[model samples]
Target: MVLPTFVLSAALATSVAAYDTLLNFHGAPEVETRTIDDIHKAAVAEGGVVTLWHGGDEKTQQDALKEAFEKRFPGMTLNLTVDISKYIDGDIDRQLSQGNVYVDSVILQTLQDYPRWDQEGALLRYKPLDFDKIHPGFRDVWASWYAVVVFGWTNIWNTEKVSEGPVEYSDFLKPEYKDKLVFTYPNDDDAVLYAFDLAMQQNGYSWFENLLAQNPRWVRGTATPTTVMAQANNSYAVTFTGALGLAPTAPFNVSIPKNGFFVTWGQRAAILKDAPHKEGAKLLHNFLLSEEYQSPNNTGMWSVRKDIPAPAGFPELMDVNSTNPIDFERFMADRERVERLKLFFESKIGSAQGLSPLVDDL
Candidate 1:
């Protein structure tokens, strides 16, 4: 029974290799196949229920989504929990720690959270059918998350009040526009924060210093600028999430700076590793990226899919000026730098005023 050391080592290595292969083998044949029909049946077999945590303006869209899902799948039910993305992430942390992890899938604008969760092995690594069709910049390198839509953070002005709009960030500093501009406090919204960051990098900190002298009003939420613009409460908003589709009839116009604007990868979605309804979760995840949901009229968002056309009245993504391509990984990883930048801006412009939407009672 005393074999040579080399022979024994070889035998042990072979056995270990075989064990590793067996351990890595994913057992589900249907999961391997990954067709829409297969996922549908699997979802139905898994009691046909999935809960989603969404961070966006999904309040009105969720109902339409539920009806559509039920119509398509007959028995499946979709549960949508809507709130700020940061709130959803906080809930996920609480739920996971408490051993309840109820939300099956998450669709949110805060992409920085996705990488963090995926690193902790919290997200399921399942790429939908059209994952390859998405632009490389929009999806995770490891397939843990994918951008479902596109949107931007930019400036807007009440056209009736100011017939001509400012085409540059510095334009807001003009004497005539002084004290007439309002902006969503950059610190309050990630998109606005990123936009401010980009503006600083492009135009220098002095741009902010001079602009601060204009006495621009600041609000907490990204929607506040557009809301104020519609009410004619402010002549201009230096930054807000650009969505022309919203209130198209209002006497307002939005514009991205010719020098640059921060366009964002909107509402990235991912499944949880321990999703309660695995099949239904995957099915719903894929359905959201399908041509049907990605259509502008249906979702009111620009699609990430290559074949889908740009939303009506919107320029092609390539045709626009997206200042610096956002490296979300680096942005999220360098927390200290971001904090320092925030401090610098606050020191120059002043601490953000008003309550954060995240903290404000719903």
Candidate 2:
């Protein structure tokens, strides 16, 4: 392993000279194409250490990637720094500003950053081996970043508590469910906020207005609602990217509202242009999108590859009623409106810094 290190310290300060030089750095000039084996050979020759900074808890996800990568490449090491995407982004920005680039690659759910990175010429633009097999909705026009998974912001209910599940967003506003639900704060999660954005387009702002009247308890992390619902303290949750394929064996179970739904494009992954271990980073990025890693058995979320089938019980991308298939370009383009929505949500939901008692690891 790459002597696992964390670069989250706030003390890392910027140097204008370092920033100016490294900011324009792009590892080895771009090439037309390279076969997977060619890429593998180059990666092995480059000392095989690829440091990655990502969002969300590392737990099952990154642990699985580490095992799979070592098993496939033998000598390669994948050192991952897992935390909130916002925090990881901050750390990376500081490191970049100081010209102390530690991470070779970054995969984050913060959709806005991918385009920004591309604009700054900070991303390596090599397409993955199976780039063409990706669904159009998930593809980046610039090819600087691509989705590794497809996730949804929807409802999950405690089967032990709710006899019947909500059919749509408005159902959560009912008197009976008031104070009986928990959710990720809309302001804290862009995906969740996008969900509300879609809901407003379909059901109108009244949906959020009425939902606020019900007063659902809010949590900060996207995964917190599922955790809170499982505790039985909250009967239901209407936020967070739903985990697919995993069988529900406990008190909580995930559900997609039939009336409408929204999906978040998964981690937008890219190799940093100035990454010290560029070849290794390229290998890891390709491996992440490989059929094995994207298989339903390996990933709980839906894979972006069209060749892969959804797990038996889970619905395929085409089967779902995606009321508003998020156009990431448009979503990112409307930053001012998104900020306004966040501010509007904060006015009603109070602070977005919610902490669920059970989710201590975050």
State, as a TM-score between 0 and 1, how close model 2 is to the true structure. Answer: 0.81
Q: What residue pairs clash in candidate 2, if any at all?
A: 27-273
Q: What does the lDDT read for residue 85 in candidate 1?
A: 72
Candidate 1: count of backbone clashes, pairs at least 3 residues apart or interchain = 0
lDDT of each residue in 75-184, candidate 1, tens digit only = 78888776777677888877765668888998876677887776565778777888777777778766778887665655667777776667677777777777767776
lDDT tens digits by residue: candidate 2, 1-362: 44323442322333333333345445443442686668788988899788987776434446767778888887788887677776677787777667677789898877778777776666777777888787766767557788876655556666677776676777777777877777767787677777777777778877777877877777766666666666644355443344433445566566666766655455678888789998998888788888988987777666788889876676776666663344744775677988998898889777767343224654
Task: For each candidate in the order shown, give its overall lDDT on alpha carbons.
Answer: 0.69, 0.70
Residue 358, model 2, lDDT: 27
Report the CA-based lDDT of candidate 1 relative to the real structure.
Answer: 0.69
